[model samples]
Target: MEKLQSPARDIHPDTRNGLHPVTLLNRNNLTLLDTGTSAEQFLQQKISNNIAQGHQDAFYVADLGDIKQKHWRFMKELPRVKPFYAVKCNSTNEVLQMLATLGTGFDCASMGEIDMVLRMGVPAADIVYANPCKQVSHIKYAAAHGVCKMTFDCEAELFKIAAFHPKAEMILRIATDDRDAWCALSSKYGALVEQCEDLLKTAKNLNIQVIGVSFHTGSGCKNTHSFCKAIEDARKVFEIGKKLGYQMRLLDIGGGFSGNSEFRPTFEEFADVIRQSLNQYFPNNKEVEIISEPGRYYVESAFTVALNIITKKEVYEKGADGNSRRKFSYILNDGVYGTFLDFYLVKEKQKLKPLLGKDFATEQELFPSNLWGPTCTNVDKLVNEFYLPELETGDWVIFPNMGAYSISMSTTFNGFPQPKVYFVLSKGDE
Candidate 1:
C-alpha cells in the first residue's frame, strides 16, 4: 500500500483546536438544522457527525448517556398529535425513556420489545404491537400482560389472536405505494385491499375489536402523494369495516418519513394531507383518532458517530492500460463490529466529514480515501471511496445522520465495544 498525498493549498485558516475534516468542508454551506443547536454543538465536540451550526430538532431526541433512560423529547411543542416511536429503529432503553417523556408511544415489533417498554414504566395502553407477523409466544405475552392492541394482516394471525387473546384490539395492516419511496415496505408486510376485507371478517368472527386500519408506504418516503394514496387505501378499509358492523376508530399511517434526503415534504403539508384525508373520508366522525408512526424523521438527525483514525495506508490500482490510480486508506477504531453494521450489511449511504478542532487548518490538497473499521475481518470497510483533506494517523472522523439505523444494527463481531452515546438537551437547566 502506498500513501496518498494531499494538495499543497490551505482551504481553511489555521486554528489551535483540533480540526476534524467535516467542519472544514461546510464552513459556510447552507443546510437545514435537523439536529438542533445544542445537539449540533455537543456532537461537533464529541462525535464525528460534522454537524453545522444553527441546526435544530425536527422530530424527537433520545439521550444516550443513561442507556436505560430512553426518552423522546419533541423538538417543536406541537399539539394534537402523538408520535409512536418505531421500536425497530433503535430500542435502546435511553431512546425509549426519552420518547416516554414526550408522551410518545411505542410501536413494538415483538413481545420482547413490548415487555421492554412495559418495564420502562410505559403503560400497555401506550403501546401498539405493530408487528403483523405475531408469534404464538408474542400473542400469549400480549394477552397475559393485558395488552390487547396489535396489528394483523392475515387470517391465520387473526385466528391465533382470537383463540388466545379473544379480547385483543386489532388493526389491519394495509399495503400502499408512494411513487417517491426509497424503500417501499409493502412486500414484507401489510395486506392488499381484497385481503383486508377477509381479515376484517375473520376479526369479527373471532370477537376481536377491529379499531383501525394501518398502512406503511415504506421507508424514505419523500412524496406526500404516497401518503395520500395510503390514506385513500385506509378509507377503503374503513368503509369495508363499517359494512361489517365494525367501527373503525383509528387510522395508523405507518412510518416512511425521510430524514437524510435533501428533498422532503413539509410537516405542515404532511399534516394537511392527513387532515384532508380524514375530512374527506370521515366527515361526521370526530371520535376517530389519527395516528402516525415515524422513526427516521424523528431521530436520524439527533445523533452522530465519532470514530478515531488508527492507521493510514496508500493503495495503488492498475488500470487496463497500465495507468495507476493511487488512494489513501484510513483505518478507524470502530467499524461494522461496533455501531455501523448497517452501513456495511445494507450498503446504506452515510455522509462523512472531518471533525476539525478550532486551531486546525484545512489542506487544499484532495486525496481519495477509504475508511476501514478496526475489525480483524477483511470485510470491515466503512467507506470505499471518499474525498478528504490530507489525514494522517490518529485523526478523528465524524459521520452525521447516523442516529437511526446505526446503533440498533450494531454487533459485537470481532469483540469491539459499541461507541458511547450522549444526549444534549436545549431546554433551560433542569
Candidate 2:
C-alpha cells in the first residue's frame, strides 16, 4: 500500500492536447522518454540504433505511457471494480511496477509470481492468489509470505487450505459458459454452479473463511453475455455463502477481458455490461469489494516485438492452371516457441499478420510466404498464409499488440533465447 501511494501517478497523461515531445532519447537500451518524445519516435530510433550497432536479437519495446493511459481509462470506466493486474499475462517488472504505482493490485497465479510482486514491495494485502489450482509448496509459500486472499474451486483445495493455511481468505471460482472464448478456461478450472453450495458448505464445516466468489469468462472472451452470466452465478453463490454463515466480502470477476488488437468487445463496452450486471445483482453491497483480474488489457497493446529475419528461401512451383506459384519462407530468430505462442495457440482462419519493419514501396510485388521459427523441427512453422515483399536475412519484422501471453509462455527448448525488452515512457512520463 505504501508503495502504491506514490505521487508520480498525479501527472495523468494528456487527454485533450497531444503528448509533449522529448529531446535526445537515443541511448541503446532501457531509456525513458522525456519532454517532446513519444513511443513511436523512441521505437524507430531504437530499431535504427540496434541495426546500426549490429544488435539483431529480437527485442520488446514497452510503452509505459500506454499502460498508464490504460490504468486511467480503467479507473474512469469501471470505478466500482478495482483491477488486480494478472501477473501471468506479462510478468515484466516495468509493467507490474507501472500498475502498482497507479494503485492497482496484483493477481499472482503462482509462488514465483507472488515472490516477484512481494519483492517489488507490494503488500500481500494487495495481492490475490488468483490461481485456483496450485501446488502445496506454492500454497505454503503464499501463506508464509502473508498473501491471504486466494481463490479455490474444489473441495480438496479447501481441505488443503484449512490444513496448510487456515487463515486464508478463500474465494470460490465458478465456471462460466465460455464457449465463444478463444481460450476457454472453464474446461480446466472453475467449479460448476451446482457445486458452489457444496464447496461453500465444505469450507464452513472446515472452519475455513470463504470471503467471496470468483469466475473467469475465459481469455479472448467473445461471448458478450458471459460476464453477466458469471456475475449472476456469483450472486447465487454469494447468497449460498451467506446462508452457510460465511461473511463473503469479495467478488472477483476474473480475467477474460480482451486487450489484443483483435476484434472483441471494447473495454468500455464490457465495462458497461459488467457495471449494469453488478448494479442489478450486488447493488448496495458496500461490504463486498468488487475486483477484476485484467492482465492483457493493460499490456497487450503496450508492447511491440521486433524480430530479425535469419534466413530466406524462395520456391517456385507450377499450379494446376500451369501458372507459376511463387512462395517464400523466412526463418526468424524467434517464433511460436518464443514470442508467437498466442498466435500459434489461437487457431484462426486469418491470424494477425506481422508488419515489415523496413519500409517497402506501396506497389512492391508481394509474394505469398510462410514464416518459420529458428528451430530444427518441422512443427516450428509460424505464419501459414502471409504475403510480404522480398526480405533478406537482416530484415526486421514487427509484431504489435504482442504484450499478452506472448513471451510469458516462451521457452528455450531449442536454445533460442527469448527477446530482450526495452521500456519507454512517452508524453513526459520520464
TM, every model: 0.80, 0.90
When summed lDDT is taken over every stretch of 10 residues in candidate 2, the lowest stretch is: 1-10
lDDT of the candidates, in the order given: 0.66, 0.81
Give a tens-digit lDDT track for model 1, residues 364-428: 55557888888888888877667666677655565656777777787868777677665544332
Which ten residues in a row are the worst by lDDT in model 1?
21-30
Per-candidate Cα RMSD to the true structure, in Å, reads: 8.6, 8.1
Model 2, 1-430: lDDT tens digits are 0111122122222333433332222222223444435666556666676676888898887778888888888889889989999999998776777777788999998999999999878899999999898899999999999999999989989888998999999999999998888888999999998988888888889999999999989888876688889999999988988988889899998876766656567877888998899999989868789999998888988888888898989899888999998888999998888888877888462265577666665667777788899988888777765777777988787777889988789998789898888766765322
- For candidate 2, the lDDT comes to 0.81
Model 1: residues >4 Å from true position, as ranges? 1-37, 43-80, 178-180, 261-263, 266-269, 318-325, 345-363, 428-430
Q: After superposition, how far is residue 1 of candidate 2 from its true place, in Å?
A: 51
Q: With candidate 1 superimposed using the best TM-score fit, by how many Å does residue 336's alpha carbon deviate from the native?
A: 2.8
Candidate closest to the true structure, highest TM-score: 2
